[model samples]
Target: MNNHFKTAMDQVKAEEALILRTSSYLKNVENKNVRRNHFLQKGNQIMKKYAVAAALAVALIGGGSGVYGYYKIPVNYLSVDVNPSIELGVSMSGDVVEVEGINEDGNTVLEGVDVIGTTVEEAVQTIVESATENNFIEEDGSSVVSITTETDSDSVSEELTNAAEEGVTQALENENVEAEVIKSKIALDRRDQARELGISPGKLNLIQKLQKLDSTVTVDQYKDAKVKEIMKAIKDKKKEVKADLKEEVKEEIDQTIEEGKTEIDQTIEEGKAEIKQNVEQKKSEIKQQVEQKKSEIKQKIEQKKAEVKEKVQQIKAKNKNNGTQTTVESTTESNSQ
Candidate 1:
């Protein structure tokens, strides 16, 4: 009888350990670090195996930084891709990143130049300032450099264009590069033409601009139009579209805002489905720490004395649609007088 009592004690110890482990596991389900679908699947299994009162309660709480991407409504870039190919991509914060080559001559001009951390204005100054200091060009105090800004921006209110032009012109004059500053803005029609043709807006813009001048020009008719004609057509189309950019910007923003709400809802549902499936697979695998708990769970299933606490966390995720935006660009001739 003493041996029988010892065996009973050992069984009770195992059962107690199981209860402790399962209880801890349930508590962990409430942990934010744990994925929510884990609770959902495990919650479903517990519900099916045990009474509703003792079973798990499931609240599928989900959310994320939805629609993760980037778009540029008014992407502005300044470049002088002459022999040296100098292009400066300016960010919303005015930070400059070199998007083009620093050829031998370009490097000579930008030597010791801290272009990385500098603002657009400061960066342009650095280039032109270095150019003048190195005597790359004769500074005769005459506006010899023409600063024209091209973009697909639809807002006259966009200070980036004129701001870039004025800023660059000033930088040139500060060091006496003696360059003529002529600011030209280009806005293309049917900005969606690029999407339809699977080409860059800038490329489609040039094609469409050519078509504007010669109604015969079309995407399929590219071979008929010489490269020279296409280039000239875009220049002519510039004046016409420049005045309409600001109006178009206002309209584009309104259009996107209205569509984003519906699109975001669909994306959330898709995200939830993916999360649930992944969680189910992960929960099916038993961990070493909870190794002995599974059998104990079945044993305790008949007993209603054990207590299980239900913790529910609700997640409300607001998704911001990271949609695509159009960008337009144009380059000048190699030697601009």
Candidate 2:
């Protein structure tokens, strides 16, 4: 019995060792799974962070291109000339992308004027009003404002030109400024030529017009002249040309009227001569017809007189023969008694 009890205790000890070994194996497996899951979750989180960063970079690049495209490109160009020449660059949405003075006077006018990102109308008004204040536009003297525009399409050019004209007029009126606003469109090539000469396109255009009216005028001669002076010269030249043309037309009209009167008088004289000749010819023909009728009546009367004389002589001869035959018959009867 003692040997059996010891064997039983050894068996119980062996079973307890097997159970502890199984529990230890399960705990090791659970720890391994927990560690693997932790690693996988950390890896997933790291990948998500990389994906978010890449998406943000793409968005910034795309948004940056859009910003550059809208704000950087210029779609139109314009210039204002009032003895102070200023040029402007316009964006696609009609904002003033750039403003620059082309000369010393232009710079003076643009001093402290900030027009970027403003509408073209507002920019134009501000510039013109500033010029007025600076005495570039005189209150007691008349002045001219020339606004020129250049663009890819005629419609846009006209629209911008009209807007500029309105803006200038409104500003001048508001300040009680006495000035004339002239609007025009400048071609691209002409604009470049104006830039080369260091003049606004509006001034260049006016100079060209002045040259046309007065052939003696040169572009360089009036390059530094004021716009008001150039406009006055043009006006005077036009008036002179108009007066000369009127005199020439009057002389031509007088000569034409004289020639027409002479032709009419000569035609009347020729008609009178023809009518007199026709009347004389008709009278001569009527007189000859009357003389012929008189001669035919005289010849008929002479023929009737000759026929009556022959009949009278035959009757006298017949009477004498009858009387002689009666006398002979009476003598023969007496002899027989």
Candidate 3:
């Protein structure tokens, strides 16, 4: 009975040891499964992170390319050119007349009457009639009266001289200033006149004088010395008047010039100020534009980042079930090439 009891105790001990060994083996298998699951979770997290990073990088590259393209677009430019030209002519028309005679007082007098007419023929007839009626002819047929008309030429100089003498004689009689007719000449000395008048030749009143014969003076005298003396006196008086006028004009011109210079300087300064203001305004505008573009680019980049993040999340979810996939598609569907 004692030996049987000892053998039963040994059998119990062996069964207990076997049970402990089985429990230990099960615990180790559970630990290995837990480690494997943990490793898989970590790998999934790493793949998701890589996908997010790749999408972000691609989006950044695309956004950068878009910005580069936007900047590469050109703006239009413009500009203008200017050029600037003058023209200058003269016109004339009129008739002539002749007169000659001695009055009852028997003073030797020769006269030519001009019948001032629009037509040359009528003017001549009127002049002859007037001379005959006034008994101003010596009745010599050789002293025949004639009428002539000229336009735009120096050929009328002789006729003009005669007319001037006659007119001067008539004027003398009218003024009751005794004067005898000798010689007359219609002289046009632009340089001399301009020099004597102390004015630009363009400013001279030559055109005004040409418009009316009454505006001009006719010199009538028998003695050349007397005429010269009279001309000298007239020239001296004109010179004195011109000198006085020039002095006054010069003073006024100087005042005007000074005022104009002041105005110009002020205008220039104001223009500079305005230009500076405009430049500042333009700079501000440019800054605003740049800032606006930067904001737009930043928004676009952020949007792209968000899109990339979303795509990465989608890829992560898809890869969680189907694993990651890389696809490349290329098409060369050319009609000619």
Candidate 4:
């Protein structure tokens, strides 16, 4: 049993020694990330045997908690890129997988944050809250935040960027700090320029140079750009796009108004034609009625004239008969006398 214990002690010491040597070469968080990634990949292959060995060693040394702290980090990761650069990774279970950032005034804001969840916004908010709690940004100071994901898929990147903007805004409100926030689906290819004692992830393109971030750009123009340059480029591009949309909308409105005017003019012309046709038909009907009345009056006048002439002739004939009778009576009286 004593021999077995000695063997376990020797194995644990050997593992500890190997870890320390690798740690010495990790000059900064980025270097540490690369090396830690390598170890994770290697651990996967040898975990079955290593776990058995580690378990035996732990049993002999009675340090389970110490062993757990070394192995809880996961492979999923995210990186916050801004004037201050940070690489934040998470576990599959949404726990703190890995976090890499600066150690200075405004950049080291996320040192002791507890980031858990699948949302980019929440992570950003937590970072701001951490900063706020530490008074990283004063009430009069300004800051900017940008977010990127490990997934290179365009759709995912867009979603995460949108969430990040909201998250940063919330963080500012929570911390009572005001600042302009920009969202980028594309990751910054650079790191921070924080001066440190040893080797680091190298000088990243920090966005602190973008106090004047009002320039024009396209997605293609932004490849591998510094954070400040990307800011200016995106702003300029959006302005152009907005102007184009406004022109298009204006043209559409003008076209609709012209069409309505044309339709109304046609309707008025048709109405005028219809009114003229109705007036002409009415005039023709009135003329026909007048002609019929004139024909009836002429016929009636002719009939009345004929009747008057007949009545005059009848009276003259009657008078002639009465005169002959009177003359005969007078002659008879004379002869008798």
Best by TM-score: 2
Clashing pairs in 3: 98-112, 98-113, 99-111, 99-112, 99-113, 100-136, 101-136
Per-residue lDDT over 247-291 for candidate 4, one digit per residue giving the tens place of the 0 to 100 score: 999999999999999999999999999999999999999899989
Candidate 2, 1-337: lDDT as tens digits: 3698888777765577898998897777776466434432333233334435554565577764544544434556788888898988776556688899987888999999998878778889999999998889978758888888976456567667877888898889878878877888877678889889988888899999988988899888888777888888899899988988999999999999999989988888888888887777777777777677667666666666666666666676776776777677677777677
Residue pairs whose backbone atoms clash in candidate 2? none
For each candidate, what is the lDDT? Answer: 0.48, 0.77, 0.39, 0.55
Query: What lDDT, from 0 to 1, does candidate 1 have?
Result: 0.48
TM-score of each: 0.31, 0.62, 0.27, 0.48
- Stretches > 4 Å off in candidate 2: 1-70, 212-216, 286-337
Give the deviation of candidate 2 from the true structure as CA RMSD: 24.2
Worst 10 contiguous positions by lDDT, candidate 1: 65-74
Tens digits of per-residue lDDT for model 1 on 240-323? 566477679878988898789778988898899989878876676546336568657765863533333111111111111212
The alpha-carbon deviation from the true structure for residue 92 of candidate 2, after best TM-score superposition, in angstroms, is 2.3
What's the lDDT of the predicted structure labeled candidate 2? 0.77
Please give me the total number of clashing residue pairs in predicted model 2: 0
lDDT of 3 by residue, 226-335 (tens): 22233344456567668989999999999999999999999999999999999999999999999999999999999999999999999989976553222211123242
lDDT of the structure predicted as candidate 4: 0.55
